[model samples]
Target chain A: DAGITQSPRHKVTETGTPVTLRCHQTENHRYMYWYRQDPGHGLRLIHYSYGVKDTDKGEVSDGYSVSRSKTEDFLLTLESATSSQTSVYFCAISDLAGGPDTQYFGPGTRLTVL
Target chain B: AQTVTQSQPEMSVQEAETVTLSCTYDTSENNYYLFWYKQPPSRQMILVIRQEAYKQQNATENRFSVNFQKAAKSFSLKISDSQLGDTAMYFCAFMKHGNYGGSQGNLIFGKGTKLSVKP
Candidate 1:
């Protein structure tokens, strides 16, 4: 089951408020990723980390930021939430093996902005 | 940049029957990976199967298998003996095989196809 967990399974906040989502993994994998799932768009990558203190943005990282201070924790933060930012956030982990690295996803967090 | 496409937005199959979900991707890199992920109503994304670009042989896991056509850039998932539990939203994803910062190890996914298995 990848041993992945996301905190605040469901959250609601007002516009302009800052929000952070947590993704924790017990597999000790080297790769972690944050993605948002929206209708008609499916899943879009927001940010990912390859190691501790190493992070980078994805295709739709315009308003999202990420931090990875340890091997097991990766956090995604929205400096200012907007109504359009509401989505189901998913955290995935991969070991980056020599061959194909299959990613395992977490339960996902549903966020709503008013 | 690479893009994955799933033509079917929704599909249905009768229990005990077989169904195939089509996925097409565009990539210029020779080294990469393809995967099919299933997201049930529970909201958990599960890895159903994966096929390596270098390997000609298709990947199989129990009732789940993939038809890898590298030339056509087509990867289709075949589910045999479909069951009620097979109903879920299936996603097709692609990832390049390298450590190129954010681009590496990041999966580009398609819109997804909803599969309904009826009894």
Candidate 2:
């Protein structure tokens, strides 16, 4: 177990509404990542934080934003939800400080946008 | 730009049998890492095995092992003594080793292979 937890394991929202998912870690890991898993797409990186206040965009970052105000918390927000955004979101924390770090994932959040 | 490819979309194996899932990747970097992750019905990504590019020996974890061929840019996973609980969606992923301005620490994943272990 990586000591990671995600809030609101399942959520349903109407289109154009804003949704925010929280990722909290107890291990004080330096890196955190958010990904979405779809049927045909295994998992695509949405956003990742290397450290508090340092973030970067990922493969599928459109309509999504992330924040890392503290070492243990990373938040992912959907500016405006869309039906196409319905999918499973996952939060991961790297076990090490650098590259080739083995990422441990938390139980995903299932979101449905109507 | 690195991409991982898993040609087999679905695979089936009888209980107590062995199965190998093929994964081929394209990359220009010589130093990197290869990984295999399992996602079951629980929806959590579990790390099954990983292989370092510089390592000449294959990595093995109990019943899970990987055939890491750097020359061919192939990293295939072999599951021995497949069990019913081993059924899951297997994903092949790639990560660059150093921080050379590429997608380091970020994993590029293959679509996935749905494996079924039948009794």
Candidate 3:
């Protein structure tokens, strides 16, 4: 295990509500990523942070936002939940430590919007 | 842009038998990396193996090995002596090289193949 944990392992929220998921890592990795997994779509990147206060949009970042104020924590928030946003969200960390950029993942959070 | 494809939606193999999962990627860049990740029923994503495009030899980790045909844009995972523990959804991903500093470290993934290890 990579010492990564995701809070709120499962969540259900009604449409138009605000939802936030947290990813915490103990490894102090330099890179942290958020991805959403859906049937027939594999895992699509939502957002990622390279360091505290530095973030970038991924392939699917329309309804989501992310912020990292510290090395160990990265947060993903859905400003207004939508039914299409329902999926399993995963957090991953990578050190890029002179080897292949192998990313270790957290347990994941299942979020449903109705 | 890069794209990963896993043609097989589902596959099954008897315990102790060998099975291979197919993955193909399209990339114009010459330097990159390929990886296979396994997601068991518990939904924990585990890195199975990785191959660097610059390396000619395939990469292997215990019972899991990859066949890297760079020219053909193919990367396949072969599991020997498969066990029940191997039953899971396998994903193939691609990452371009030299994007270490910022947003480029993100990975592009395939739809995934479901492997069932039968008793």
Score every model by TM-score.
0.97, 0.97, 0.98
Residue range A1-108, candidate 3, lDDT tens digits: 799999999999999999999999999899999999999999999999989999999999998999999999999999999999999999999987837677889999
If the candidates were sorted by their DockQ against the true structure, best first, what order would they fall in?
3, 1, 2
lDDT of 2 at B82: 99
- Please give the fraction of native interface contacts (Cα pairs under 8 Å between A and B) kept by each candidate: 0.84, 0.65, 0.81
Cα deviation at B99, candidate 1, in Å, is 2.3
Rank order (by TM-score, best first): 3, 1, 2
lDDT of each: 0.92, 0.92, 0.94
Q: Which is the better candidate, 1 or 3, if ranked by DockQ? A: 3
Q: Candidate 1 clashing pairs?
A: none
State in Å the error of residue B84, model 3: 0.6
- Write model 1 residue lDDT over B12-96, tens digit each, in one string: 9999999999999999999888999999999899989988899999999999999999999999999999999999999999989
Worst 10 residues of 3 chain B by lDDT: B97-106
Best by DockQ: 3
Query: Once model 3 is optimally superposed onto the true structure by TM-score, how far is the C-alpha of residue A57 displaced, in angstroms?
Result: 0.3
lDDT of 1: 0.92
